[model samples]
Target: MRIISLISACLISTAASAEYIRGSDYGFKLWEGAAYTDDESGQFSHCVVSAPYKSGDTLLISFSKDKTLIVGVANDDFNFDINKNIPVTIYVDRRQPIYATAIPVSSTMVTLSMPNFDQAMHYIQMGRTMKIDGRQFSGIYDLTGTKVALERTYSCAASYYDYASAPVQPDAPVQQEGLSKTALFQVATNMITSIDVSDAKYLSEAEIENLGFGAASVFWQSDDLGILAGTLTAHRPTGDLRATDSQDLALMSDFCEGDFASSSQKVSHVEGVSQRELRGICRLDDSETQIITTKTDIGEHTLYNIVFFLNTEKAGEVKRAEATGNIAIHAASYAIE
Candidate 1:
């Protein structure tokens, strides 16, 4: 499925005041068929990649300047009320259905916003097909080139946002021979800001030091959710030495005092960096705690650990996807400084 004349029609109808800018190709039949800018201000508004099916329906995926992801559908034969919101369920392969609200942009086009961006991207990249079920319309679309398309879209956003050129403070300490407290604090602060932690309150440097958890630690507590998350960096001189399961258990034991029963463990890589993630339950008498820890090698014989301790009683209320997503962002954002 490739986009044709429908791309122009979809974009023009979706946003009347937007003008098409340059086009970009992401390979494998995925192209930025509609890169739009505001007609009045001449600024980038959004970029879209689309696929048209034999049924005359076109599937569109777009990324806005404000970092909103939208999945929309366009059909010439469809006639819908503009600005109407409809409830819909999206199913990717055999994964659980995502319930979302679709807003009609035009009489023939409707868009749905993804609530869980990481999960949605994962499903689209790994799945073969996506089915949208709604009261007004339903269809299944092939997801062949979505993985590369999404990667390119993310790259486009990063370049447009100038993330690579983001300035680091000149006085920020750098990690050279050993772990520096100032460097760790700066890295932790950058990680927190990058992840956009607006709901939690972070502990001060004095408070963190008073806790006796060592100098290379940053802790944030969400009192409303009863969750404690922190990062710990340690200097380990074992170059290129991959920790075994027993060694991982021993390391986890240092962070979790109670008897730990490992529920799952896996190694994930992002942007050439590999991280070992472990999730388990800690039990001591009548109390239980859920712990998630990710260990990543940040070059120069340094290991960075992100640990999350969740209250077992409020575990269901906590957004585990967001937590794990933050860990991934941290893994990708952290440098040896």
Candidate 2:
């Protein structure tokens, strides 16, 4: 998955495109592509999900945040010849062939927009194979995950605007075995101003909502175990956060002592983006709870603070919860550059 993201970045740079990212929840995959201006400023962008062929080519369907749908295909190996009216036939599941005009993007890629995008999606979701122009040059690609992926893709895309208008409410809790606890809260989206759009191949509006400067908050609970884990974006602090010297450590220690008992502080190194960090572990509520907090400067004045609390009785859940939290924060943190 990481390799795919990296390659897509290179493809975008050589193609000279906007910052975007790809995310998946079900069988379909979403790509948030951007269009920038000559002043190195973003002009506009949108969310798109594409199906990849075995030959390393892809057929993409994009959903503009404006509520329009677009269809296109890309092959990094193609030596495409541009013509004003390029004819192409797209066949989904061997149904009646649909024809459209192909617009060449580079020597390697081309796209076409069709009016019947929903119909095209239907054919792909049925685990049918997609072929172009009788498949003389391209290989057949499976569309098994198209349905679920598309739903997740659009949901995340919509989340960008949804949060702007109002805080998004959490859906009903997901059922977990041997856990009987739940935590829920709404985080105001206005705290975040904009995303750090740099070197990213595709940036989904939804991703920007949760990244660097957006109002990103999380809530989860395990009912049976009474375990709650949450984190959120905070206003930038005025003082330097990268201070790991004696004076800074002393200040942090004092702060931790005021909030947690038997607290220990240290300068810890986390893999990925180089930055100053302070890690502290302490017992709260008379040692009944363990609190682990990390503060890292993702960018100048942009600090990401992660907090974790776990009950002593729920040791089994700690590993899974910690892993999920770390993976999410790490991904979001590194994307800033």
Candidate 3:
């Protein structure tokens, strides 16, 4: 059944003045599916699966804790007004047009509620491709792996609900204490004292931790140059955790989604810690992505990873060169205080 009448009601109920904070820390993965939590509450929020198409559009499907289903489409070229609602239509394998309203969550993304969750899932799973027609754009998405992804989403939502409804134990601890929030940040910042990022935007400790990274990690985004630079630390493995040549190449291939190459070389020792540098380059449809990563074994049970990523689509040649040079300089200058 088409969900024509539920659009307005859904929007009215979901519209809020409070800012929305999506948690990036994921609980588990089933294929390309992952369950995310609320950043503020740390409670399971939704399970989502996304796929990017060759046309540069991404299709997103999610099941929320409220038992509602959402379908979203995103493209970097889109610049919609946030919170604005626009009429849209969905077509599944020549099925009748399903009318809905799309609410722009960001400048580049819009989401629509699927009132008929079961029917929608059935249609999507049985269909080969789905198409969406918005007021300003239209896109076709392949439905590969959607069946498994949607099933995983349902399973994740159910598991979370069961856990939430379970009785609390009196002796159960609410939280655990670990390292200080700023411990990683302090050490990383001290290690790269020569690197200057006065103009870069720094991510908050909570934000970094929510990204499944170390709390207070030294991370910054350069919007102008389309680069991301970060240093993250994790517990050192008891066994060797170095990536093999083939594994490194596979990682680059997965990220690039096109032709890619990866090479590793030993770098000068830093404070008696042996350093290994990995370089990767990938050619995508409209952009080239480059990665420079330096790995070092720091303190006992601590491994530090310094990474730099640059996208050529948003940066010029000169800017890209400058960014890579800065990455090298930072890696070379790293030293524990």
Candidate that scores best on lDDT? 1
Q: Against the hidden reference, what TM-scores do the models get?
A: 0.42, 0.40, 0.40
RMSD values for the candidates in order, in angstroms, are 18.6, 18.3, 12.7
Per residue, candidate 3 scores C-alpha lDDT tens digits across 176-251 of: 2222336545534533343344446677766664443434356766676666666654333122335333333443
Q: Assess each prediction's global lDDT (C-alpha) against the native.
A: 0.59, 0.41, 0.54
User: Which ranking of candidates, highest lDDT first?
Assistant: 1, 3, 2
Candidate 1 residues lying further than 4 Å off, grouped into runs, are: 1-16, 23-26, 30-34, 114-117, 159-337
- What tens-digit string does per-residue lDDT give for candidate 2 at 1-337? 3333333332333444434321111122332222212113332234455556667777665554466655556677877665543666777875877675566655656666444766765766664567666222444566655654455445434433221111235895432221111110221111110111122122233543333212233433344443443333322213344442232233223323335433324333454544343344455446544434444444422333333344566434445334434533453443244
Off by over 4 Å in 3: 1-31, 114-117, 162-337
lDDT of 1 by residue, 13-114 (tens): 444455544222222353334345555555565566677788888877777677877667888888888757888888998899988777777788777766
What clash pairs does model 3 have?
none
Better-scoring candidate (TM-score), 1 or 3: 1
TM-score of 2: 0.40
